[model samples]
Target: MPQPESQNQPIAGRYELLEEIDHGGMGSVWRGYDAVLDRPVAVKLIRQQSVTSPELAEEFVKRFKREARITARIQHPGVPQVYDAVLDESYEQLFLVMELVDGISLRSYVQPTQLLPVSWAAAVTAQVATVLSHAHAVPVIHRDLKPGNILISHDGTVKVLDFGIAAILRSDVTKLTATGTPLGTHQYMAPEQVRGGRTSPQTDLYALGCILHELLSGRLLFTADSEYMVMYQHVNAAPTPLRQLRPDVPTALEDLVLHLLRKAPEARPADVQEVYERLEPFLPSPGAQVSAPGQAGPAGVPDPTSIFRKPYAPRARAGQQSAAGQAAESATAQPAPPVPDAVRAAIKVAYSRSDALLEDDRFAQAAEVIGEVIEPAALALGSESRQVLELRMNRAAIWLLGGDYRAALPELDALSDAYARTSGPSSERARACRAQAARCRAELGQVTDALAALRDVLDVVRSVDGDVSEEAVELRRDIGMLFLAQGRTTEAHNILEPLHADLCLVLGPDDEMTSEIAEVLAVIRLDLDGPPS
Candidate 1:
């Protein structure tokens, strides 16, 4: 936890601390001004609590400084440029200053209701892959790759942040992160990371797989009541296939995501370059139109795919004639053909079969059945038609039920849009659709968005029905859980404590939902009380 330090204090005579932008388990990230350079910089104040004794602290400082230097050596646009690493004479605090990214954390984008387009998600992952390629060349393993550490700049560039835990692959350097202790976030940790096995580039790849899955599904790959459970899943469980979650996801893309999540590092993609190559097809091509009608557009945000599509894109010079330009002008694209009624009937039967399969927990079969109809339905009825959208939505639902979020998220988002467009935005159906999407976001680790969406839906539900309605109660419960996930225990307690009381009064003490809330509330109270001394 970061204590609020007074502002306007200049450290090392050059960097002036301004305000804290973010904080985490390791340290606080401050938005600082560099007096010498006359530019804004992000100053990370490492938490002293990470060390125990004086000798260990000294060693930690050395390792931190060395890692910072190694991080600076990674030359890539996707990585924030490292400016300086300063150690005070007292050695009480360590500061790392780097280029301040004007962007939102990737965590914000992992929303079930407003999922990124396939092209957008692919583009972001591809850029990350490119960055990893460069970093691996210098033999630096990020060691920690999570949504929190990835920033999407206003310019649409993906910036990888926080190399604090990064390990330089040098034989002479002492191992700072000792054996028998894992160093990454439990949710994104690779199997090897959980087992305290040697971390290589493959370790980062595993983390990337977790991120990509979350990005695609709007949910984390795995979750549990405790960190130990999550770690156990990482080491022992198999990831649900993306196609089983979202029928719209390309088979190749789903295969790639699964490949990246392989328990054995060797079974994963050979390198980040290979990952990038695999992602190339999903990325927007040069001069290709990226947005479509009825789809969520970039809405003024920079497009990440623009880098690969139009590197150094510039305005066409006045009266400058180009052969490629002429060819592009002469070419005209064809529209998709309409779907026949016979195909529609086939789609309906497939959907029914899928529903039955889903009930039996045959997620793969359910998804495949629906998937077989999606292409034909889209082609015949138009991709955005109500029937086609419903088919897609059903497929997404199957994915969600099967715990294949990456596959489900995009479908839910598209369905949300379709429902809003067809039925009014505030319609009960639309709200329900949005709520389901938010649930997916929560599962994926987009706590802030999930809380906001749930609250919004809860307000509507309460307005239409009442505060104690099942929908409202469920929304409140979800909001509280999201708060807990964000480590805002007080807020979680505030919400869950009341909600649980209400549930006990209305639904009875032994009701499943009430009991669930009670269990969570008890845990929150424990957290609020602090550990037994």
Candidate 2:
């Protein structure tokens, strides 16, 4: 075994590495500070604990450097900005200084809070989407976003903690596959990704769906007590309904969450922004607002056009072996139907310990452990308790990751209702339900209805949460994405750029949002600047 290095030692004379904060297959994080800047910072030291060969170690350092450089390019309100990356003496280690987030992982939050009220769960997810959008904007994909990587501050500020597995979508493809790193979380992997296929914005969307499910349920979405079982489930099993577990969930919103849980990548929403937009309405208060009696002129049926654009299923890649691969894959890999009581209970217990399996990137193990818990728990425990609501959310999220969006919807709706009662109309819980509902509608080609649903919350959201928080920024970003998807390039640009600019100013140039907005702009350029108007 490699001996642990002494805490509080100086590395490169620039950063004082304090206590060990965390360790991954890639590196160890430490509570450290910059001697020059004087502000405390967290330093992640890339592990050189073992190398199959000394030659590989040299190659490892180079790969790590290349990866670090790509990470440094990211900027987002919800992602830690890396300030420095360097090699230590004898070039034994590589360390990166990142903004220290003063809170626990989302995992910790779920355990103690267990089944966060719906709005709050949506809030966490929205912030995550904000981070993802930004990361993807650099055209970089956070191939490994999970609960542990999501950090929430004491005051509720959130940041995504690692860039280790971030994949740059640039021409530098050589760097990613060079060391043959088997990147990403298994349970959260999109169907295309799971099949060792192409990746796009939709890949991250699948992961977020899983993460969102976990946060809402305090549970994992897939399980069978083994990695293979979990991977098999992700590839083949259908998820249990979220509402059946959480009886209080609203039907409309739950429908949306399940849509994200679809089994085929092409069946899932085209991008993460779509998820955010769909979910935003449910994030607001549930009580409908009456337009103050006889209020003003021209109050025709609400403009359904504003909230959503059509959400066609994502087209399979051009060179894909079959143009109807999505249909064929779905037909061939139909998921396992919900099983009996005995089987369900066993699965739930297995899925609850996902964190234990995360280190080895045995995401399949973690997922299986988590997924198995859902069905049995719903059977053994009444669906109305806090526990059930939590389980439902998790199951729905897994369904989302599996590309079983239809299955996830019911759970999201159920969660919204429970949160409405638990946290009340004014809280973030209520808002999550509204937002998630919108996301589902948008994904299902109910763009008009999706926007309308989102519009339904505008009044309540504005009243309760008010404008200008990160939550508000995320909502705006969602709308921007909706516009872009519909080819309303100018409209999308106008809404997103200013918000993007604001994120840059408040969070700095390296924030995740900075990259997300830029990426959106890049897409707009390709879609609008070079195409038929």
Give the per-residue lDDT digits (tens) of candidate 1, residues 325-403. Answer: 3443355354365448788789879978877866657675577678878777777777777777777777777778878
Model 2 poorest ten-residue lDDT run: 296-305
Per-residue C-alpha lDDT of model 2 across residues 387-494, encoded as one tens digit per residue: 656665655555555454554555566678777887776568667766776777677676776766666665577676665576777787788888777777898888
TM-score of 2: 0.51
* lDDT (0 to 1) per candidate: 0.79, 0.64
TM-score of each: 0.57, 0.51
lDDT of 1: 0.79
Clash list (residue pairs), candidate 1: 216-406, 217-405, 217-406, 219-444, 220-444, 245-399, 246-407, 338-380, 339-380
Which numbered prediction scores highest in TM-score against the true structure? 1
Q: Residue 307 error for model 2, in Å?
A: 22
